[model samples]
Target: MAITAPIATINDHSVRILAWNQIGSWLTYTDANGNSAIKYQFWDGGTDANSGFIWNDAGSGQLAANTTLEINAADLSQVWVRGGAAGGSETMWVRAFDGSDWGSWDSFTLTTIPNSRPVATISDHMVKFDQWTRVSNWLSYSDGDGEAATRYQFWDGGTATTSGYIWNDGGSGQLAANTTLEVAASEINNIWIRGGSAAGSETMWVRAFDGHDWGNWDSFTLTSQPNLAPVATIGDQSMHVGGWARASNWLSYSDPDGDAATQYQFWDGGSAGTSAYIWSDVAGGPQAAGTAITVAANDVSKIWIHGGSATGTDTMYVRAYDGQAWSAWDSFIVTSQNTSPVATIEDHSVHVNQWVRASNWLSSSDPDGDAITQYQFWDGGTAADSGFIWNDAGSGQQAASTAVTVAASDVSKIWLHGGAATGAETMYVRAFDGYTWSAWDSFNFTTVTNTAPVANIADHALHVNEWARVSNWLSSADAEGDTITRYQLWDGGTAGNSGYVWSDVGTGQQPASTVLEVAASDVPQIWFRGGSATGTETMYVRAFDGIDWSSWDSFTLTTTA
Candidate 1:
């Protein structure tokens, strides 16, 4: 084998290859603001040393004909771009030499992310974070190579990290994903960690803290943008707190009080420059002027009483101003009551599933409240008469439909506003278990409060051979003083192995405890919790074998939305 040494050099635009081979290269100058006024030449390899060459080529304002540079007998074999212009460190792939027939163009090479570091500890290695994306909830990413991580850490941006990146090892503790976490939900108050999941994606859970003991980490999961955190806070005149809003949610507050109203505010996470809103003088006028609103980790935006006038029930509209544009009226009339409403505007969320369980109000209240009159949902204009009527409509408040998990998808088009308008305040949250109704859970909020409605169904998932984990936070409360929020899971099987089991990992906080999951075990099927105790949360899942249990591994993936 023979190794050849490379060579190259140039004095002017033309390199004196041997002697007669000296080819003078000149750049063709153009006028209309072109970037090609420079002197580098894209010679086509053939050049004539003839005296009139330069004058002849300049006449056409471009290469007179296919101008080709000639290579002397021993000219450097490698053809390349002659260097000129700014510093020499420009990106190589994007700046190729311009040839007679070829123009310089951008190369297709993608920008490179640093490769994942290798690992020296643990069974499987995990790297890269899938936080707050618009696709899969908490879909993690890491180099699948056996190398151990150089460092490991979880950050929510709420707490600043000196370095945005985490170095593996002694910086953070180590734990198995099985005995570790399940799934996670990013929220405002109770941001859950130790989020986990299992096979069949059925089992799910999260660990949460209210600045107190870790409560049973609830079970939950998102269909989109899992890490998308809560963005707003809601409250009434008495207690101005405990409100929940997702990425693009729009909670409506109607002002029935003939006059306008006022409000309080605070929130986080959004592009402020693009997320601001404007008020219009006319009904449905364009957003005139307003500061750019961003939903950062801690920044806040609120629509207070701009002062409304006019006598008697003049219905002031409370619409949501998404960064892109204003959604339809979020709420209708506020009347005399002062309220800071709350609602979650989901993504591509078309039809809401309202399973009619034993629905109805107990015999009492208004003169017409004998046995609970009728049920009708709304789509802004008028209430839809087409709703499933319950045969055994029980005596309780009907469900008002608020989000269980805020933005599983995106906040773009799905501003959840439509709902039941004329039914009793409370309703049952029922789910169809492929057969009968899985029992109804009651929910209610006062007119003086800004409590948004609750989602009527639990996140149900299935994993073969393992228990169908159902993260049911569908607890309820009745206006009659009986509030029941305990959710039950059941499988129509001969044995009890198919029913829902109540197990918790994270302490349930308002927002943090919003994440959950059903995970797969080492033995084809298993269930356990994932996430963290502190704010640095992760997704993990564990499985239980009849004889023993396998360890938990943090979920590492990059799924397409």
Candidate 2:
């Protein structure tokens, strides 16, 4: 029986294949007679059956009618199926024979699936100076074909892949421009990046390949952080009062970025906001800052604390600044030691047996502004000398060293007596603050010799039987300014003789005894009568002070008839 050409149909119509990949399909043909044998021919390209080769597989010759056969592209040379364009149609010609007649070649086409390009995306990343960071951590990739990347390119600043670097699956090494490398997708995670010597923002480009085509160039910003701030440290320190507390003595600076400190600030208390007092000068009077003081790093020692006024403990805060930013605040203890007071004394002169106030020759001052609360007096330069310190009234006295509190009303009224011995003497004094005593201050005390008084009498001329005033005839003078306390008059040159000494009784002068004594106020009222003999009669008179008596003087009284 004559049979029409078997109708050619493909069993798997939706099957898609890649270039150079193997694909299996089932071929079915229709035959009218059940006993008719079927044969098929398969070829690729050219017109139907004129330009391609015939398939000679075991299943190519079919015996039964309406039978199915399996066809695989792996059986053909790789170049046969690879001739079609990517993601385009590939044609295969097939014809069937029903034992006697062969039908025109029937064509069946299969589509080649194109490979999806791997998409690469990179986000902006932050890098610190001199710090290394992983480049892959900021990169992501996707492939629609579920293929892994086989190659990678990195651009330092631009999207020119030929001028950038490449990495391979074996290891990371420098690759020439316009070069290719075979690298696994997992190996790309080893990529790392580090900021250069300078710190700033820059752009970088990257692309990945999925063994076929490279993805579009993806860019990202790599911002480098600024330099690190300096580190500040301070140690506790101790200083005496009236001394400056310098920052260089305790503060230290360091920086991880290798930068030096440019400026610094200081606070009085433990914290910067603790607006306390800090002085820049040794006087510490008006050059004070209640908040903070900022100065150059070179002048670190110029910054002084406020401990000069008094003695105690103080807390100070300090910080340093690099070219970029300031460091954290650091605190330290400033211990102010106590300072003793200073004593001073002046030389003094006094008369013998005179009492002088010791406090008048003694004075003191303290550098720490502490008050002089007490005083100690000594007879000599040292505290072990024997000297008398008398009370204000000169009633009570203490030998050698003696101390008195400032609270006493007469504390500074200390009395010292100049003894009868006339010469130079030394006295020592010391002042005490609340803390300690000052060094002894010695002073010279000189005593002057006493001089005796001089007695004088002018010669008196009076008529016989006439009473002339003798008050003006007797006068006294002293070199030491001593007052005349007593007077002696004699009729002759002997001190025991008393003549012309009269007493007033009952409104008239009466004859008096050979000797008479009277008060100094009554000396002016003494009246002397002319002696019976008018010739020159020598009368001697003398004056006496409390300490010494003056020499005797003589005067002549003349009577005329």
Candidate 3:
């Protein structure tokens, strides 16, 4: 990028901006004005400054991690600038921000998810992991010395997810304690471990072993919780947990007095604690256990509880959001009691109740207490489900709280709605790329929302030929109370030059004119009107071989029939 003039001022600067999704690099600048750009730059850095501007590397500073500079505005006016080159793969992402916080938090990972078939490789005594593709997964030298008799295991629901993944010492080799046999992902979903080499008792160090970094990798005891089928996904620098979190401080306490929790409380925010905000209820009712909630794309969180009370009468709530605010009593359900109330999240149709992953339909549930008895998937709104299933069957019921593996093709536009009865209903749609379920659609209503839902539509195909009679038709609609009309223009095909006035090209429409086509040597145009000519009639500029439509840009058609 070539910089003009000796001084690039806020008033003068032009550039061809280069942008790549989230991150962009601009050959931007700074103004040596009343404010020391650096001091002033850093000054606004923490204040009201925008992160999008840093892409310019404005003599102000270097690009920070997890953020984009805000240069599109005059805030950085004195610092004249424009688009430049493209950044790296880690361009588009989120950085943490607070009205009063650091130069900006190290961007937040909106979706913490599980990668499909996470892979693992036994390395340096640790288990290294890898997701579907990018990002390595590995358990560094923690428990072991990175050597010897290491038995790697890739499991699901507690058994070897794949044949080759479950490797045991078989009392053959001797893996040392803390030898840290890190593992990397293989052709499996993911790799975790219960290895104490000498003790033989399984020690849990549960974290996605991405070949690169382990995000808040958690460790658990295999004895208390014997089985877990979790999913982890690595996006940009964002790592997520998709599987059910088997542990919860909330469930750890049980009142011997049976008085129930004097108060039910939960605080959600960064890392579940940092910058956390609290929510509590004074023994108003039973408290649900576990912090491990189902976090769908866009931060939608859900969980199933089997021990709120004995009777299965209370509502089964699934919490959700778009980008802001959380909903109370979002999901509902009805079921009996069973311990293994599996709550799973899958993209490809996973086995639920007892069905494979198909774009048509899939589901999740709590095996007992709040088992899934009904299924409803929304493509942004109730109107979007293809039939009733996400991929096929649109309506049904079951007895489990497991992920409904929607046919991969039916993702993105669909949503997850769970409820036991009807009063307290919880449901929200998420954004997907037909592969991974990223975040939930944040757009939701405050009360019993009846906002018009967005319809997922395939754009209609429009075509024309030399002997053109643009017979165009589109299947779209306005709100239940509104009308949407369709129109087209060849502009006489001067590429995009002519404007022979558009007219009524259809009948039974607001403008009652069924005049649709014109000959090769003729040109016709049409439009609609409400209170004129014939109450609601189609105005036209009839058969113009080469003539002005009319003084008013409209004319009567010379009827061929």
Candidate 4:
């Protein structure tokens, strides 16, 4: 193991030196341009002066092309350039001369201007707010000596820090000339500026220590201009109110700053821009204008608006907000709408012979405060077959035929003629909305409990071999105008009356009568044949009204055989 001392040469001149390590041998000198040039030379084994090593192939006299230099040769190296340009610095490399061998060349820089600091210029001083963009060619530099690179420190609220480049430097604020910078959307709201040499006219300061001398520490304000306000536009619209007319209608919009709409407002019905029509924010229900809408730069914003409930020649105004500001109101007009009238009919039940009439019947209502022009009534049932006729038939109020005209909001007395039948009857009616008829509504009326026909027969006397003959022998009268459907004749005591048992069939008695009508003269001949029994006989007769039978009427008759 042998330890060898190193030797070096520069400008082809040998300067007296001592114990130099082969790995590290450096020197510094001022060039004609006043720029500091540093060179490094190395050797594997050598001694001062009489050592066995010389720089650059010995007789070549200068450093080789591939020779290298170390800017910071110390094991721990910290470097900062200064004074090259206002707000700017530069780095350079030179050939290193070595005895019989050329070392690799490296670069270093000067950070000192005799009496001036670097100046900076930003390309975009005023940015449109609520938008994100890159500041290309944003910060430029101009130094009195020369320009190398610019290091920037950004501040949002106040002055930049004097300690280190902080804020949004994109990790490292030390950047080359004409480099682009990016600003976030959230950061461009109020204040933003770059601090460095050559950034702007604002006086920025820097400190550069060249081993012994320290540079000036002065603060320079970077160039800063307030951002412009975002631009927005809302489109006009027109439509009707309520029902199908008020659905899916929207107003168009746009914003230049690519802002999202956070609020929407509109007027109900009034002159545009007058504020006479109350302005209301659209949140939900009929007034909700939708949510989370965005527009691109110089592009249209397709924002939708719900017209809500409005009618007549309504003048409406609309505006949109992009979280920062509200756009001007856009105007539109809406036409009036017509509403349909509603029709209704009530249900009822009554005894037979009580006819359904106009007094208690159908009714109608109009929604648009308009009059129900007319009411049309219809009756359909089996009652029509059996002499059932509406009293309004002659007045053109017949079922399925006529419309009752009215000058008011409601029309009543629409019904069917409840016939003598023992059952239900149905009628339908509808109201006209001036333009069209409403949906038909139906009602049911029942006719029940018909009065049975009365059976009257006078007493009679006859011989066993003879039959009695009398005109108007049995007569029926019904209160409900019901005709006798059948006659029942029984020859016995009254049934369930006074302990007189009356049976449909008995000894020496004729069969009961099934005839709806019997000739007035021979009613007894049909019930008894030649007076078959020889004793006082009792006979009972009753009438049916198609629905039910009347109470039996008894007549006593003396008979001889």
Candidate 5:
């Protein structure tokens, strides 16, 4: 009897089988003559199987299937299964036997599901200029078929195939452009990216592969931030009047990008503007306001500022430029400190009890150009009790450690009186500006001795009726070159004797007292008259120099009838 063709039924016919998965089918038909089915055979391709006959699941030989047989896709190899007859539509032949010859091979259709491409997505990211950043968290992929992504590609620009790099798990370096690179499942999360030298928005394309096909190219924007401006800070500065302050010592700068200051600007006041003055030299000579000074980054320490003419505090504003942008203005306090006046005194020589002029011994100068208003003197140096200073008019004397207000014109009138003791003597002096006093300056001098003058006179003869000039014998001299100021003539050794000295005027001989005083020019006009007895009369004469008097001199006058 003829066995009817065995009919084949699949457990889930509508469902498509994934590649490399096994599919099972069952036969439900009865033989026409009621024969029991015993054996089965399967073939690939068509019902009339030829060289494409189905092999055993172990790939050993032809397969003899029972009512149900598991078609092992693993045996077909992924290539044959994936390359189905018509775009994944595969055909298989199956037949059943009823203890007799096998029925005609039945054809059934099987479909190999295509692998779903992993969807690659990338989110926008931000990066600093010239910095390397990671792109793992910014990239993502998904596959509907539960497949893991195995490879990834990156491109600098929007296009993927033009020029791109692939991640190399071996760290041997990036693969060639558009080159597919295999990676471990864990390595897919460690992608890295870097931006170019320029700072701006950048676009790139990325894709992932799940062993089968590459996903669509995903684009992401890389925003590179611009270079940051430098920050500037300034510290307070202190300098003496007429001194200089360097900007580099007080002004400092820093940048987040490590950029150096390339240019600098300076202002005189607390704010930046061109209204005030800023000197460039120590002398406070050349000056400018709110101007930019060109300088090398490494030479910023050379910038200098002048502490102006006056003593007090001043403010200065400054800023720096870093190729990209200028930093904010910073300020520093410039303290112009006061400078004390310098005092000086010169050594002098004077006689004992002589008066010395302040102008010849004391002087001072102030660096800040302040006036020297007052002077104070004290006994100092090798010898104490050197001298004493007098008030403005020399009317009153002042002791040591006293301040005297002597005007410039009165400097010559203010006297320093020499002490009673004679020898090398010293006195200290100091000058005072309007604000401060200078250190003590020493004044040194030597006291000398003075000598008296000498008087020379001769005895004269006089006639009773005839006048005799007695002044012709009078003469005087001094050892110190002092002029003879006055002269005294007497008769009885002292001024108490009777009248014997006389002066002859144009009218007649005037009877003068025993003592006679005359100026130095009148000494030649004196006339002496003898007494009535007239034998030997004595006259005493003396001369006076400006500082000391000469000893007494004697002269005798005689009268003849």
Candidate 6:
């Protein structure tokens, strides 16, 4: 008989034997005349004919005529057969007799198969942290002779092994089929996971037994999963030529996987164009892509930078690392240099009637190295609305408050004449680049008054018989070289009182010339004559300039006989 065919089957309340009936009837029959007949006998021994079989005759109470029997193929011991199969191989023998005829011996064979090994699979092919996960059994099988059981092991980087890692009872580290395993990941870990399985094999060389013999161990590998990268955020930033940005005040970095940012990178000046921009560590220098920074988790830092001798708006960028990978770049701005000009002045003092130049007094420069495009001047004070002079016609020129057009650079050495007034005068100036203006500068100076001239004359007397000359003793001078334009001559009395008529010539007086005569016009000298009963005559003289007159000088004369 074939091994797949059943030698015996038990169903309902009866057992049916197919192969046995083919060999012979193992049954007893009864006829209407109350006589009993035997067809076959039951057996429990090796294959050897009716001697190896046990017999139960009809009407002898040994056989129940058609008694029911049960058998179990899964458990060969319950088959009620003799001996047992080795390696799922076994043989049996039986024989039956009909009344007076005997049948040849019949035989039956039995075979049983063993169970197969189990396979393991995880619910998530890429297992990650921060969530509960299960390692379920998938496509696992068992042979007809056994059942399957499974266990798991884990490793950080590479494949897992039984001896390499200790197996827990389906807990945190160890895992089993349909069981859960959770691993918490933080910034401190490098985060790469590999899962291992020990299917049907918990201990060394030991397999799971399912009411039968043990099975072999089988394992599988799961895909590796890594942690997430960090995120970097940049805040608004601004800096002057000599200033720096404080990282703590302007940047934020974090990770979604509960990890801390391990490093920071920076790029300064212009655009952060692709890979052309070199990245630098937060602590120092330009570093490679994977280089570590000196900053700690959630810590603050500073980025020092200069204007680099350049001006105008500039840009900067930054990024962070979570020990495993780098985050996307974040951008900000770094303004460099300036355009406003600075102004300075030098004070001066001038004597009255002197001239002062304005151009040589003030100077200015731009911080950004820009050209000094424009300049303005204040006459008396530095008030914004004060007297300001500006160029109105040329490039970068402007009109002053007085609406007067000034030529570019016409302000150079502009002369200022000091008047008679003696006091301090102020002049303020400011400069501008093309974009911005500078603070006002101030200059102060003083003007002094001029001295006046003086005249002198000596007293002289002339008798009626004697003539006197006064030109040698009369003179006038001025400290400022002012010319003596006029001279006046008069007596203590009016012309009627002296009764002497004097001839006037050469505008009444000339240096080193004789005085005019009273009666005659031919001589240049003046001669005093005695009047009727005159004792003495007095005369006064003075000099006059365009703006002032000298002090009067007087002369006395007596009549002589």
Best by TM-score: 5
Which portions of model 3 show Cα errors greater than 4 Å? 1-404, 407-409, 412-426, 429-485, 488-561
Tens-place lDDT digits, model 5, residues 1-561: 444554443331222232333333333545667765566555555332211223354545443322234333223221121122222544666666666556676776655456678887888876555555556666777988788888776665423332223344458465454334445557765555654455566567778888777888887776667668888778887776566666777777898878778877766662223122355433334445544555556665666776655567767777778776888888878777778998887887666677767777677799978788776666542335455677666557765555666554466667777766677767777777766678888767667665667877776665553455655666778887767888877666222232366665352443343457677887778876655543666667888775566777876665554
Residue 201, model 3, lDDT: 22
- Give one digit per residue, the lDDT tens place, for model 6 in 161-211: 521122333244433333323322111122123233332112111123333
Q: Please provide, for model 2 over 1-561, each residue's C-alpha lDDT reduced to its tens digit, 9 standing for 90 to 100.
A: 555555555432322223432222345566656534355555555232222222333444321222233333234222122322345554566665666666576666655566678898889876555455565667788889888787777776623332223233346554443344334566776666665445566677778987778888887876667668788988887776555555676677899977789988877653323222465543334234436677788766666554433456767778898866899888878776777899877987656666667766666789878778877766642233223467664547665544533432456567876656677767777787766788888888666666778888888776665675556677788887877787766665222222254544222343332344445566766677665545555666778765666777878756555
Minimal lDDT window, size 10, model 6: 11-20
lDDT tens digits by residue: candidate 4, 205-280: 3233222223343343344332323333333444323333321234465676566666655555543331212212
Candidate 1 to truth, TM: 0.14
lDDT of 1 by residue, 1-561 (tens): 332222122322322112122122221222232222222333322233321121212333222223543322222222234222111111212121212222342222111122223221112112112212221223232333323222222222211121112111322322233343222223221222331221111223333332212334333332111221122222221111121222223342332212122221222122233222223232232232322222222222323322122111212233322222233432223222113211211111111223322212211122211122222221222235222222222322222243121121211212222133323233223332111222234434111211222222333333333332223222222332322222222222222222223344332211322323323221122232222121112233322221122233332211111
Score every model by TM-score: 0.14, 0.35, 0.15, 0.31, 0.36, 0.29
On lDDT, the stronger of 1 and 3 is 3
Better of 2 and 4 by lDDT: 2
Which candidate model has the greater lDDT, 3 or 6? 6
lDDT of 3 at 32: 27
Worst 10 residues of 4 by lDDT: 76-85
Instruction: Please list the C-alpha lDDT of all candidates, in the order they appear.
Output: 0.25, 0.61, 0.27, 0.43, 0.61, 0.43
